[model samples]
Structure formats: structure tokens, C-alpha cells
Target: MRYSREHKLETHARIVKKASVRLREKGAHGIGVADLMKDAGLTHGGFYAHFDSREALVIEAFAHAMDRSTERWRKLAEQTPPQKRLASIVNSYLTPVHRDDPGHGCAVPTLGAEIARESPKTRKAFAAKLEQMIDMLAEQIPDVPRKAARKQAMAILSTMMGALVMARIAGSSDFSDDILGAGREAVLGRATSPKAGKPRARKAAPSAPH
Candidate 1:
């Protein structure tokens, strides 16, 4: 049966949405095309009608997951005060709820390492979404130049991602919660510090000693 163009687009989006969740729950190579199609309520043979290859689907799914992540952050930024938006994002991202639910959480910490081994096209797609996330983060950062905000965003993302990954690896909920708390404190501390983004002045050597 021939589906309408709008229906086909909806089906394609459904497939990508399902793939996005599965790809985060299971790494890039962990789930198969058949399983993803099955979960999306379609047959394996129908996969090609929407995507050229499994890799293509994976790339689209990664982008979709990141889109959801950034959209949530954008909303958080809107509701939060300018001074507290960054910390609000960090707290929301590092919670035990997010830590326990890889299928529904941000794709970066879940799939980043696995995607690094994917093809150039896949890597390129991932990199593009990552940059969008960084830009969203940069916007929440207060009182810094754009260039410095970008750098601070990078640090904030790195800390959150690394801490989340470690928390998942530690195999205990208590430990996981501790990791999240520590990570939140560290990132927010740096971001809210009085001298954040400023260079330290070098001490002058004593002329008499020379």
C-alpha cells in the first residue's frame, strides 16, 4: 500500500525517534537495524524506504536525540534566571534520574565514545550537534565574552559528560549520586566564581634577589 507523503514523513520521524532512544540505550553498534525497525512498528525491509543505510539512521537518530536535549535546555534557560540558568541545566542533567535513564537522556554521554569510532559522515553529524549544544550552553553563561563563553561551555560539558559516564560505570546508585553532586558543585563553582574566565596575574620576581 502506498502511504501519503505526510504519512511517510511521520513514519520516518517515528523511526528516527525510536532509533534515537535505542541508540542511546544501546551503543551505535549495540542494536541492529531489524530491532530498531521492529520497535518502530515496522518491518526490517521497510527500513530502506526512509534511510539509505543503518549508519544514516544512526546519524539522524543522534541528531534527533541532541535536538531534544537542547530544546529542553532552551526551555530551562527561558524559565530560569540568567545568573542561574547554567547551574539549573547542570543540575537537571546530572541527576540520578537522568543517570539511570540512558534511553531518555542526552545522547552525548551515552553515545559519544561509540560514535567516535563511526565513519566520518557519522562523526561529522555528531560534531555538528555537539556544537549546537555548546552554543546553547554558552548562552546561559553570564558576564563573559562570546569566545570565553564558548570555552567555558566546553569545560562545563566535559565535566558533566565525564561525571555522568563515571557514575554509570561505578555500579552503585549511592556512588552515582555522589558523582553527580560533586560534578554539579564543581561546574557551578567554576561558573559562578568571581574571577571566572579571567587570567591570573603573574607575580613579579624580586629585583633584589636577581
Candidate 2:
């Protein structure tokens, strides 16, 4: 008895989707290949048929999780106009709900640091997906240049990731709230302000006085 290629591909997709959720809930390093397989309702040995190794699965799963997260953000953007989208994105990213629920949250805030230590292939996948995600976010800001939009998106991402890391490390709700709120204010205020497009004034050149 053999499975058709379409069936195999469907099974692989199911496994990857389940693995992505589990990977976010529990850090990627925390979940064993066997456990992930069992959680996916598939036999452990079947894992090799879909992916070359656990590393391969990890990268795929990360990509899957990222895509899910990005789609959610895009949908939110669709409901709002461009002028308000970035602020909405920042507020959503910094909430306690996003902090407490890793399974459905962005991969960058959950497992990005761990992915950095992974193989170049895994890192490259993250980088490529990250750029695509940022581009989609940038599209929500009207009249902004590509480079400026990219920079704003990167800053928003960094602030969200950094705030979550600090909140997790501090282990205090008060501190966590402070970190999240401050980060949210800083990012949203700066990114949405008119100053976002204005160039900084340079100091006057020193005079060659006689």
C-alpha cells in the first residue's frame, strides 16, 4: 500500500502546520522530533520521508508559522486605512495577549533568537521570509520610499521582539507592562509621526575664520 504524491504532500503540510504551532508554544529546541511527530498524529519514522532532517523540518515549520502570522497582520491592515495601519500593528504586537500566546503569535518574537544559531539554510529562510513580511507591512504606509518604509518596519519588529524578550526575562507583570507600553509608544509615535519622513538637520560646517 503506497500513498499518492498529492496525499503525501497533504500529509506533509499537515505535519508542518502542527509542528509550527508546537514549535512556537515550546521553543524549537524544546520539542523533540519524536514528540513533534506524535503530536502531528504521524509516526516518527515518517518524518524523514517529508524532510531531510529535523533541521529541515524546523526551517519549514518556522516558515509556516511566519506565513500564518504575516497573513493575520495583512488581514488586519486590510480592515484599516494605511495611515493607521502601522500603529495598529504596533499595538497588536506589544499586547499581553501576544506575549502570553506564542502558538499564534509572530515567530520573530518567539523563536527568532534560537533560529540565529541554526544552520545557514535555516537562517537564510528566516531572512527571506522576514524581508517579504516587511515589504507587505511597508505597503501599508502610503507615500513612503522603499528604503524608509523598510527601515520603519525593521524598527517596529525589533522593538516588539526586544520588548518581549525583556518582559520574559524580568518575570514581573509590572515591568513587563512598562516595557511593552513604552516600546509601543516609542515605535508607534515615531513611525506614524510627520517626522518619519523629515530629514535631520546637520550642524553648520565649522568656519575657516581669519
Best by TM-score: 1
TM-score of 1: 0.89
Q: Tens-digit lDDT track for model 1 on 1-210?
A: 899999999999999999999989988889999999999999999999999898889999999999999998888789878998887788777765676778998899999988889899999999999999999899998899999999999999999899889988974456665676678779877422111112324221111100
Compared with the true structure, model 2 gives a TM-score of 0.85
- Find the 10 residues in a row with the least total lDDT in model 1: 201-210
Q: Could you give candidate 2's per-residue lDDT for residues 1-210 as a string of tens digits?
A: 799999999999989999998998899799999999998898998889999999999989999988877887788778777788776766667665666667877888778889889889999999998988888777777788989988887877777778877765665466676676667668766422111112324221111100
In model 1, the runs with Cα more than 4 Å from the true position are: 190-210
Top candidate, metric lDDT: 1
Q: lDDT of each structure? A: 0.81, 0.75
In candidate 1, list every pair of residues with a backbone clash: none
TM-score of each: 0.89, 0.85
Q: Model 2: which residue pairs collide?
A: none
